[model samples]
Target: MKKPLLMIVGAIAVLAAAAFLYPNAPSGNAAPPGKDAKHGEKGHDEGHGAEGVVEMTDAKVAAAGIEIVTAAPATLHDSIILNGILQPNQEALVQVTPRFPGVVREIKKRIGDSVEKGELLAKIESNQSLSVYEMRAPFSGTVIDRQISLGEYASEQKPAFVVADISTVWVDLSVYRRDLPRVRLGDAILIDVGDGGDPIKAELSYVSPVGSADTQSALVRAVVANDGMRLRTGLFVSARLILSAKQVPVAVKGSALQTVENRNVVFVRSGEKFEARDVEIGSRDSENIEIVFGVMDGDKYAARNSFVVKAELGKGEASHDH
Candidate 1:
């Protein structure tokens, strides 16, 4: 009986030693590291182990429409925006009038008709001699207004036709009293005519010496080439007057900027990885921004569609939380 009791005691001691040697050991079903079925053996998600980083392949980037641009020296404009309207270049507009009081006998052109230089517009019968004369276009232009019709008495007091060469249009911008001193002739201007088109580039051609007392604004003029006649007369437009421009050593497209965790960040590219780096910004224009810190010259960054990378980083954080 004593020997059997000692044997039971030794068996209990052996079991206790085994438990002590393998303390906190995984269960029989538990798989080793890099062999987990749910995580595909890896502890972290693919391309997402580091914080504030997103990984995307070249094909993925192109498919996402992410435009990558290199940081470089760029000219940033100190600009002021103003509202304006497009007008026909008055210098190129001409008013056609009968030289003498006459009767209109023939009408050859109408409003919106394209005419050439010396193009016959109408025939007028003189009242003084009962003789006929011809009205011709003074230059190549579109007939914007027609004041006379056939079989009507015409006079020299009123214009017979109004023609305008609209190949180049005028942008009349309103300069407020506070901004008048900053505006000057020959300063660069960009006219946004809308319709999702690019802004038309021009130079300040004129600044009115007179200011309207009612509006308290001066009229500033810029002549822009009206290619395709997109800058039609009477259409309101917005303009950016470049008051000053400065070159910075490091700059990136404005589209690359994003706010992350209450801080401004620019996503910099490193092979397949995009790291959100906190950046200090300086002067900024409509297109580009100056990076005072956290980015260097020649650094490649995601320009267009950079928000996609930010979303990806957010996903990583959410998954980590779970």
Candidate 2:
């Protein structure tokens, strides 16, 4: 009986020594605190917290095409938007006519043909003189219309060709009666040809004194130099007539603004991370917006593609929750 008792006491002492050596060892099927079988050293919510911080490396940011810019004073344009269509500069257009009533002998120019000044367009047989007369282009331009076909009559009463030098174009904008009071000649305007390109800048050259009885709108025009022939005649366009410009102390591009967690936020750059900072926005133009709060001058932020940061933050939060 004593031998058996001594053996039980020895067993109890060995178990106590093992427990002291491995005090924090994981129990069966259980992971240690702040760790899991899948999570390894840290739990799912280890790195994220209430204050939103998105960890993005420089390479990741560059790969995402996120442009960073410092908040600074910027001009906010207060402008009126107007829709219009492009037209050829009527002043630079010409109508070519035959000098005498004649029968067409040879037709050379066609619609859409480019012509040089004094270029021969056709040879005509005059009805009275029975002599061949030459029809020449009055100026260098493109033939927008050709009235006579081969062997067709070249009449003196009708134009033989409609040529226009489209080196410059007129943007014909219709101003509603209500907006006409605000628009004036010589005001600065931006012409958008809806080709996803930069808007062309020009001054308003003319404003009609009379309003159209049919549309109750007045015609306003801007002459724009057709650089690269980008402003095609008959293409629909939009214009922003500058009404006023105000300088704000702190402003950012409108693309930087984003709505996150039911609040407006701008992703501000911190070392190796971006924080979704709440912001109050004020006046905004087509390109930029005034930052009234939560951002300060000299703060570097995601000026473009800020939605990428917002998406990353959402993903982080979701992973933390899961």
Return the TM-score for each candidate structure. Answer: 0.79, 0.78
Residue 250 accuracy (lDDT) in model 1: 95
Clashes of 1: 1
Instruction: Assess the local accuracy of residue 41 in candidate 1 as a C-alpha lDDT between 0 and 100.
Output: 48
lDDT of each: 0.92, 0.90
- In the range 1-322, model 1's lDDT, one tens digit per residue, is 9999999999999989989998876778787655686765465565456888888999999999999999999999999999999998999999999988899999999999999999999999999999999999999999989999889999999999999999998899999999998888999988888889988889999999999999999999998888887878989999999999899999999999999999999999999999999999999988999999999999999999999999988999887655
Q: Give the local distance difference test score of model 2.
A: 0.90
The all-Cα superposition gives candidate 2 an RMSD in Å to the true structure of 7.8
lDDT of 2 by residue, 15-83 (tens): 899899998878898877777788665665576755688889999999999999999999999898888
Return the top candidate by lDDT: 1
Clashing pairs in 1: 34-41
